[model samples]
Target chain A: GESVGLHLPTLSVQEGDNSIINCAYSNSASDYFIWYKQESGKGPQFIIDIRSNMDKRQGQRVTVLLNKTVKHLSLQIAATQPGDSAVYFCAENRNFNKFYFGSGTKLNVKP
Target chain B: GAGVSQTPSNKVTEKGKYVELRCDPISGHTALYWYRQSLGQGPEFLIYFQGTGAADDSGLPNDRFFAVRPEGSVSTLKIQRTERGDSAVYLCASSPLAGTDTQYFGPGTRLTVL
Candidate 1:
């Protein structure tokens, strides 16, 4: 089975506001989770990541949360800007050897 | 180079034709992976090579798809008798080692099977 998926296909946020994108994973054994941002016609760019041992991790203006019990993950962006508009993807990493990427959510920042 | 690279950015071929996608990983990276992504979908795993041997080929969809990383630096994904359903963006990634989850990805090769 595929490991990760998103509940929302598209999200819009007012510029300067905060944005949150949610993801659900099927694999209970996945220990590491990562969030990526991909612009049009470009590959995914790493945003932030969190391990199973930590519930949350922060990087720049992005934050990642991991819930082991629910197998859920989320990426939060503070002070969202117009430049933040892109497709957001969440990936699951298990066994530290394999990764499964989730269907991305397109986030639009309204100016 | 410091980043992964893929060649033949776009390819158009008829059904039953053969195709090969190439990838060059970052210098000294030992783990290379292949993935396929269709329109409006996430990338799907295909195969992985650690050093000269494939460590995981379980994700390969069928026997028609084959990949090789002979020297552990440059890798190739080969498809035979390509079908329309085989059209996708072939992506390649490389990590320092298989044990590290952080992988750097290339721009990918867009394959169109008609």
Candidate 2:
């Protein structure tokens, strides 16, 4: 079945450094993508989103890049902080209603 | 001004038992969704309710899984003949009417089948 997946299971970065998480999706029909952050004992929280029509979208210290040709998406976070340590996942909207999520990448920000 | 909320933060059941999970979506949100998350993995879509009706139920694993939203506010997910494989965190989310809107997720109900 068509699904989304992350390139790495874990990533470690310094507090002041920038972090980049990668995701690859197999569904070409997907038109929307989103990044979510899940902390310990909490549900997934919305981070940022991008549509197929656009290549990149930016939010507060976060950026989502979409590459439809390669079926890849990435989330970039600048100036990583302790509070940013969590599991990050990429989700794609293929059927226009339901979202399929990736396994997830654990982001660990070192002090 | 509250976010999505789910009842019985944690549930423990034995095989062959039945269980019901509840979800309360954000106020005024017209779209509700249910998902299942296993250990070390992301959420998998199960069903979606647009208002009081189910718009999509393609993600439901089998007939043992069922859900309903009568008043378009509180939704319940019922599981029958539970198996050990059913142990997972069931998540609920809500969004605006638009399909592409950002979804706000609840804390989730952790179900453990013993």
Candidate 3:
């Protein structure tokens, strides 16, 4: 089945440094994409989102970039903080309400 | 100002028994969704509700799994004849609308089937 996938299972970054998490999706029909962060024992928290019509979207200290030509998406966190340590997931919205999520990338911010 | 809320933070049940998980979405949100997250994996879509109607339910795994939203505000996910494989975290989320709105999630209900 077509699904979303991550390029890396884990990412470690030093505090105050930048972090980038990558994801790939196989479905071309997907038009909306979102990045979510989940800490231990918690549900995913919405970080940022981008539409297929746009290439980049930024919010707070996070930025989401979409490359429809390559079916790729990336989340960049500026000045990563220890609190940012968590698993990050990329999801593609399809069929209006249905969402396809990647396995997730664990981001470890070293303090 | 409150976010999504789920009941029974943790549920332990024996195989072949029945279990029900509840979700209270954010106030005034018209779209609700359910997902299941297994160990070392991401949340998998289960079902979706819009204004008391199941707008999409193709994500439901099998006949034993069912969900209902009677008044478009709250929902319950029912699992009949639960199996060990059904053990996972059930997450509920709600958005202002269905398609492009941001979905806010609940703390989730962790179910363990023994």
Candidate 4:
């Protein structure tokens, strides 16, 4: 069964600290991955994305790292803030058509 | 500059009833998608549409689920004989193109099957 899963279901981080969320995907054919943040009552917002050709991609205060060898992916948020407290998800895109999402990791930021 | 929008933010219906969920994509977006999210779980892909035609519907769970994207801008997800398990948030997303693009999502429609 092809699936994407997270290593941790919940992560609690103090405000101003860095936070890392991990995910493992089973499909080798997946070439693209994205991280999304969802707040209560709102839709999932795109944080960042990385292609298979790149090992690391960085954005403002955020970074996505892909490890094709181990079939793993990670999203790192620098200087986590209270507003960053939300459920984080990692999605894998296959054949450039469909995306498979993992059960999210709830990030609780303590102010 | 409006993002994707879904109508009837919430719906409560009895089992075996039919329901329709609507989605309005961002202007100029050609790709549309439907997803279902269970409590504490991530969104599950249901279908994808390119322009006015369905490009891929293999993710749909069963014959009870169907979707249409007419005129290439709006889409409706239809569910027939809904079951209790159908209770979930229905999410709609659209991208400028079919693949490798950022998908803008709408505040999902929450369906409760009683």
Where does candidate 3 stray beyond 4 Å? none
Q: Lowest-scoring 10 consecutive residues by lDDT in candidate 3 chain A?
A: A91-100
What's the TM-score of each model vs. the native? 0.96, 0.98, 0.98, 0.98
DockQ, all candidates in order: 0.68, 0.85, 0.85, 0.87
Clashing pairs in 3: none
lDDT of 3 at B71: 92
lDDT of 2: 0.96
Put down candidate 2 lDDT per residue, A66-89, tens digits, no spaces.
999999999999999999999999
* lDDT measured at residue A28 in model 3 versus the true structure, 0 to 100: 90
lDDT of 3 by residue, B1-114 (tens): 999999989999999999999999999999999999999999999999998999989889999999999999999999999999999999999999988788999999999999
Instruction: Tell the DockQ for candidate 3.
Output: 0.85
Give the Å error, residue B8, model 4. 1.0
TM-score (chain A only) of candidate 3:
0.98
lDDT of candidate 2 at residue B91, scale 0 to 100: 99
Q: Highest DockQ, which number? A: 4
- lDDT per residue for candidate 4 within B1-114, as digits (tens), equals 899999889999999999999999999999999999999999999999999999999989999999998799999999999999999999999999999888889999999999
Off by over 4 Å in 2: none
TM-score of chain B of each: 0.97, 0.98, 0.99, 0.99
Q: Taking the tens digit of each residue's C-alpha lDDT, what string does model 2 give over B1-114?
A: 999999889999999999999999999999999999999999999999999999999989999999999999899999999999999999999997749889999999999999
lDDT of each: 0.90, 0.96, 0.95, 0.96
